[model samples]
Target: MMRYLDHDHDWLVAHGAIHTAREIAQQPRLWREITATLQASAADWQPWLNDLLATPNLRVVMTGAGTSAFAGKTLAPVLRERTGLRIDPVATTDIVGDPQAWLDPRLPTLLVSFARSGNSPESVAAVELADQLLPDCRHLILTCNPDGALARYAAGNPRVRCVLMPDGANDQSFAMTSSFTSMFVSAALMLGAVPLADAAARVESVAALCEAKLALWPQRARQLAIDGFERVVYLGSNGLAGLAEEASLKLLELTAGRIATRFDSPLGVRHGPKFMIDARTCVLVFMSSKPYTRRYDDDLYAELVGNGIAPQVIALGTGAGDTLQVELADADDLWLALPYLLFAQLFAFEASLAAGLTPDNPCPTGEVNRVVQGVTIYPYPN
Candidate 1:
């Protein structure tokens, strides 16, 4: 009798969207599970991580590919500020392409991989390249699949630690939903963005807020889909910019490229990307909670509404009027991202349905895959 995005299980299953709908709806639950799971697994990863993090010359690199890659981008900004460490969000694709350039053999390194499957060709190859190229590289792998190559890569290696996400976080859907958010927050918590005492509370608060958004957003999402936007743009700043990238990708993937999409920061969009807006376009701005950043977002939002370049331009954060409003005040942009993400995922799902495409598998011909294929990983010189 479970329902998702206002659609019952039977209806969703009949439409071939059961996986996508259920996965999107279950993210808040998976996020809560991540808090408890990480807390319980602290005994295993904390000792090694504490000492590694304390290393004076340590450089942390977060990596993954595709949607998984976006997780690093979303987190790297805040994690750098909170941990007071040099955290670079380097995609696995970059590392695999040129290991010598990306993986520094000279510095003491901790490679934190945020991967959903852990089996992506680049994901595995990047880890190997790091080991081959760096003398002092330690691995912290956060992934959903325990049996994925990245997890097994830790089996006998004392330099590696694998942390599995909560149940149902593996994401049966083609696009990442529960898997992405769970790993996104998992990296935040495990890397000391929130205090140990406050981690569980912070997670619980965001999860509950997102639970409410899951209910409120679906109807609006359906209406937006019905209106049939031919182009979409997502805007934000800092970590939210990364969230914007993922948001843009979700809509693009769900609609099977029927709707073109672009993402940029509020200020950056004015540079040139604003031209993506047209009469049939939809523009969504992910407003930051920070006062300074919020001003730029306000400027952009007001300009978008005033110019009327796009048919629908909206703000997705707290404000007095016409904003979708995530409704959690005084939270970090890190936490605010979760509820905002829920809205994007739901809208993408509805857009897929409105386009008469299967939300679960928008690409039936196998051009795009749930897991990427056909990439040959060459051996790196030892």
Candidate 2:
């Protein structure tokens, strides 16, 4: 009897909708705020980032909790090539669980914390543990919640620098949409790649494309859900592979585990993991725009079609292809990530509804949260 557009769940529906239109409409405002933040604070940020880069033993650890963690994973490859620095995308969960193995006391390290709340126990604990373990370590906290612990931790601490994302980049929704993309953008710019002036056009173009394309994604996803696929296998490569992980998690979380999902690189799935595919599963491939990358993606595409194991298969990228293909118009992989992510978010939202759950609060059981919960922080003795 509950209608999807019922007023009772207005807030939930509003927040859960991650269409191309929403993202595109937000482009101008988000980019303006993002660029302004860097321009106004470049003098201060540049020196700090330079200092971190100057260290010969500098190990840039991109970290966060849940969706926040995926932001780093999505950027690690691009950052490595742009900065030519050793960058590792480590989860704060893993870091908090075992500090010694991750934080070598001998290595002078830089912990780049990507937190939406900046207050996740794991986020706070990872920073504290790193300082306690590493002989020489610096903290760069990037988050939307400025009042959260991570942002304020930089106060009076010369070793820490906190960069806050633009307003609304924090996302009021249960899921991270614009917030995830903006933070990744800030990191990519601050760490390396396109200058502020040059970044303008690309950002505008990508945002515009999203707005134009996102309109029909939700309907498409909803229809797919109606087909009743019980499982999903998402495949991508490099940066997109990390995105595949986030996409998989979103469906699992939003469906309250009702829709089992798994993700792996294009090549990695061909291994033993291929067994997960069956007639009831939906296979989604995020093909790369680059020719070299697309070759691998195509190979997997061909394999999946050949196997004819899954009931459905969707391929998304920058070119026309057999089967269901979403060809992005001449955009880099980084920009391509936005539209791809929107598809994932829409799919998860549809799945949540298909399972008769609220998209905004998929798990009212309190097992998960918009910002996480019930994590006890232990004191790290100096």
Specify the highest-TM-score model's number: 1
Off by over 4 Å in 2: 1-32, 322-330, 379-382
Model 2 weakest lDDT span, ten residues long: 1-10
Question: What's the CA error at residue 380 for candidate 1, in Å?
Answer: 2.7
Q: Mind giving the per-residue lDDT tens digits that candidate 2 earns over 1-382?
A: 2223222234444655433224323644686578667867889888778877988978899999888899899899877877789999999999988777788777788999998888889999999898888889998888989899888898889999888888777776566766777788788778875666566666667666666655556578888877878899899899999899989988888788888899999899877998889999999998887789889999888878887878788888766664444554567777778778877877877778778876667777787788778878777666
- For model 2 the TM-score comes to 0.90
Off by over 4 Å in 1: none
Model 1, 148-240: lDDT tens digits are: 989888888899888899889898989998899989988888899988668888888888888887778899999999999999999989999
Q: Model 1: clashing residue pairs? A: none
Instruction: Kindly state the number of residue pairs that clash in model 2.
Output: 1
Pairing residues by index, what is the TM-score of model 1? 0.98
Candidate 1 global CA lDDT score: 0.90
